[model samples]
Target: MTSSPDTQPIVVGIDPDPTQWLALAWAVDEATRRRLPLRLAHAREAPPSKYRTAELTPAWETWDEALRTLGTRALEQVEAFVRDRRPEVEVSVLLVEGDAASVLRGQA
Candidate 1:
């Protein structure tokens, strides 16, 4: 029987590195075989802004927006891959702000 989205989804921590999509491929295969939904989670943490007494620097919002943009791109890329590979499988994306490990742990 197929599982619903509310059921235990096959969670995979998506890597920003395109070369490291093997894990995501495996997760998609497993989720497809098990007839479960796939949750692709991408986590990004912005660098700490250094306060310079007399230097012009972008605002915190800039940094946050950049991180979110990159994270969203990464998730979209993988989500497309998974969908193309297995159109029958339900795919979901999660763009989160935090350390990868901590955010993925919360996904579990």
Candidate 2:
């Protein structure tokens, strides 16, 4: 794995799934070993409603809040995971409103 120095922090795009954490583990390991900061980013955009034709969607605000809540929970879980492994490693989190790919790219 390529190591980032102190100047550039290693960024990791964390998903909503708490059970899936291999990527986070690798990112934390690399950051601690390379002595760089770790960034945990999760995008928060309401997913497309499958019931558009039936007009059976929840309130717009409610859906948006749900997405943000999920993103926040995911970030917290990953942060705890990182802290548990290496307490000394620096870690930051970003919960942005956009697509996952775009959010991560913007972090760069």
Best-fitting candidate, measured by lDDT? 1
Predicted candidate 2 versus true structure: per-residue lDDT over 1-108, tens digit per residue: 333454788899997776788888999999988888888999886456563433545566677778888888988988998999988888989999888888888887
The TM-score of predicted model 2 comes to 0.80
Candidate 2 yields a Cα-based lDDT of: 0.82
Candidate 1: where is the Cα deviation over 4 Å? 48-57
- lDDT per residue as tens, model 1, 18-52: 89999999999999889999899988875544652
Model 1 residue 51 lDDT score: 51
For each candidate in turn, the TM-score is 0.83, 0.80
Error of 1 at 41 (Å): 0.4
Residue 26, candidate 2: C-alpha displacement in angstroms: 0.3
lDDT of 2 at 62: 70
